[model samples]
Target: MLAKRALSIAGGLAVLGWPFAVWLALTYPELHILLPILALCFVLRLCALRGKTGALSRAFKGLALAGAVLCIASIWMREAQLLLWYPVVVNAVMLTLFGSSLFSRMTIVERLARWREGELPPEGVRYTRKVTQIWCFFFLFNGSVSLFTCLAGNIHWWTLWNGMVSYLLMGLLFACEWLVRQRVRRRYE
Candidate 1:
């Protein structure tokens, strides 16, 4: 489980650093040649998942397989615009996950908070629900901007927003939420 989590963290960082990877690939032809190796890594990770049963798990495995295929295909084709599409797709997937959870028994944020706090008070539960809603909106807006930048065909602008600006905004949101949660817990708990 630790190895799986580490791999997940590395994969997320790779996605976040994709623009830099592209720069390196362009600067050194040998780096571009590593695409197949990356694809193999994806395939290996997928194979390691053998027998996971949840819908979310299956969906993620499918996405990983598709990513592997895309990596291999991109090597033979000239679909450079995919670099722009990646962030948009990733944000959309995340948005779907968060948005769908809002209609379930508990929002994703609530579920996470409960994992830490065990049973939350009614107020805490309500607050987590609101936070999850805010996250859904954030993902929607972020994905929209990513799609707009992709269509605009400016790699620099896409990289600027997706790589740096989007992450900063997310970090700001996370920090603000943490601060607010602390204050709320002190007052009501």
Candidate 2:
């Protein structure tokens, strides 16, 4: 159990630190050295998901597989440029996960809210759906920008946008959503 938890934490950290990892791999031009480590991280993450069951779990597993594949491809092709696409792929996977949930009985945000609040009133349900839509929009926009960074062929620019700016934007969005959610909750109360 402890080993499983450690693998999960390592995998999560790998995913979160991907941008910096890519930046290091690219700046040093030693992709062969780093790609295998990344692939291993993804594999560890995949292994950690072994007993989980759910669409979300499957989606995350798929993401880990994709990341591993990309790393392997970068290594095979001896191309550091391929590593830049990892962020774009991350955004695309996120968009798919969040966007697909919109058509389900409950949006992803709604499920998370329900989990926390025990059950949502009608107004809360509506708010959660809207929040989910906002997240879909964010993923789409962020993915596009990530793709642009890959195409721009500027390592510093890519690192700046994917590594730093995108995170800041995500945090800002989360902060704004929390503030709005508090107001909505008060209004409904």
Best by TM-score: 2
Model 1 scores worst on lDDT over the 10 consecutive residues at 9-18
Tens-digit lDDT string for candidate 1 (1-189): 787766665554455566566545544666876566556656655755656765456656765676577676778785544545666766777788778888999887887898798999999989999998899899899999989988987767877888789999999999999999999999995
lDDT of 1: 0.74
lDDT score of residue 137 within candidate 1: 90
Residues 1-189, model 2: lDDT tens digits? 999999899889878888888889988875458788988999999999998987678888988998898889888888767878888887888888889998899988888887788988999889988998899999999999989888889988898998899999999999999999899889989
Error of 2 at 181 (Å): 1.0
State each model's CA lDDT, in order. Answer: 0.74, 0.87
Q: What does the lDDT read for residue 62 in candidate 1?
A: 64
What are the models' TM-scores? Answer: 0.81, 0.94
Local distance difference test, candidate 2: 0.87
